[model samples]
Target: MPRPLMHRRHVLQGGIGIAAWLMQPGARAQVAAEPAGASAADFWRLARAGGCVFLMRHGATEAGLGDPPGFRLDDCRTQRNLSEAGRAASRQLGLRFRDEGVRLSAVYSSAWCRCLDTARLAFDPHYPAHQIWPALNSFFQGQGDAAAQTREVLQRAATLHPPDNWMLVTHQVNITALTGAFPAMGEVFLTRADPQRPDRLSLLARLPA
Candidate 1:
């Protein structure tokens, strides 16, 4: 099932709402006991500031990892596709972006169907989005060049400026390679390359869908 999404106003308002509570008695213990909130606000602030890329681990998929043996990119049937729930999540993700007024300048995705579908549903750009960028492809099956892909992504991101944000929908390994952050299925990360060292990416925040 799709989890409930928060309104944009609520998130920005709560961005720093709980800071003082941590300093009070039993605060650490009490705070430790609280459930985590899925925040969608922080990333927008950085995204609007630009020079960043949004890396999304494709939405949930059918059982099994990587791809079924001998899966072909040309046929979605050959690959593990998105589950119904994943589809729903993707649509909600789009709504979240729309609500937050985050317009993607470019949408890139892995050739794999699950990744493709996730981006297709989330952004739904005119005539779909990019025609698949190999750099966004999954390297989990010992197939892709992680170093090369990461470099390409970093190089592309370097050209972004304020009001320009690109979205990359890919597999877990691809995202992990670029940001060193393990994203949950369907989760998004807002990241920017280090100013001095463009090779390394700094995670700004995790944007929940």
Candidate 2:
């Protein structure tokens, strides 16, 4: 069963309030300094070396904790969507990728608006949003179907044999499910595909928050 829906206005306002709290001068510094046990340079190097695949979490969203009751895959407007900060973050993230010379051969996103919006805003000029998978949505409330869906999506990604590198803008749950690692907002994870063991994924780098 799906979770109960909440008022969009309330959700948005609440998220904005939380963001304000976190963005305080001292809090922002702390957030920026939070360690993910990996260095940004190391991640960038791995991306260059192995033709990395980046699994990114969507930017901030105004929506409440999870989806409303009876969430449907085909309809996105009803879902929790991105906020202004999220949109701006997406743009900044894109610029960061561009400045870093990260070339994405293809881009995929969760069907949810926040994920799609992030992908579009971040990498659309280079790699338009081409793929959407239901499995990539959030599992925050433990509603995502990760176990059965990840294998299928990974298989599809494999067949693509994407050029130099590929990017996937998705929710936290999907990223965690695939990499066995949790990614914070705006974080990127680099992984390499091994020919000897196609299913075996090697973690290249976990970009800092």
Candidate 3:
């Protein structure tokens, strides 16, 4: 059977978390594509006001899942990297944040090259590279500790105060584990560390890739 067509706009609700997927026109973006509305403004407001962590999946990859056999973490040549379109999306993401005057206290990336490249490409051309956190690394292939890493993200997020926002450039698996929102490459999810619930993050809104 043919797969069902995806809706351009929709809402997924659960517990105290509410995710409004707003897709912008001409935007290679998130879960659902829609014309921007009040959600976009509110998302930016939260970002600028700080006290939030933006979870970003790395820019689009060349192709394929996980890494090839015998791939090494230190070698980009051995892994799946970003494509031209992905690079363009990444650059646009950084520009969007800059144009909005949003301030991020820290920008972290997974040790993976794709994640690192997304961080460096976005925000600024000379983004001073990245601060690699193993906790944000991909466990997609079942090679890392999902439960432990998720805890680390929640713990760190709880420490962030308002006016001190943060960004974590990580993989799809990591983001899903934290918020249960599977995102597109270069997609950004506005989330806050839920101290009361160490097991989850509060999803505010989602931005396109």
What would the TM-scores of all predictions be? 0.77, 0.70, 0.80
Number of the top TM-score candidate: 3
Backbone clashes (count) for model 3: 2
Candidate 2: minimum summed lDDT over ten consecutive residues — where?
A: 26-35
Q: What is the per-residue lDDT of model 2 for residues 114-200, given as tens digits with 9 covering 90 to 100?
A: 788889888886555557766676555445564566666566556544347888888655665565455556667787655664543
Stretches > 4 Å off in candidate 2: 1-37, 72-75, 138-144, 156-163, 194-200
RMSD of 3: 9.0
Index of the highest-lDDT prediction: 3
**Is 1 or 3 the stronger prediction by TM-score?**
3
| Per-residue accuracy of model 1 over 1-209 as CA lDDT, tens digit each | 25566445434422332333233334344221111343455677666676668889888777665677888999999997898988999988887777777767788899999988998888874323655888888767457776688788888778777677788898766666665445667888887766786755667678664
RMSD values, in order shown: 10.7, 10.2, 9.0
Put the candidates in TM-score order, highest first: 3, 1, 2
Per-residue CA lDDT of model 3 for 98-151, tens digit only, reads 889888778898999899888988964533446889999987646688778888
Q: Which pairs of residues clash in candidate 2, taking residues 3 or more apart in a chain or in different chains?
A: 3-69
Clashes of 2: 1
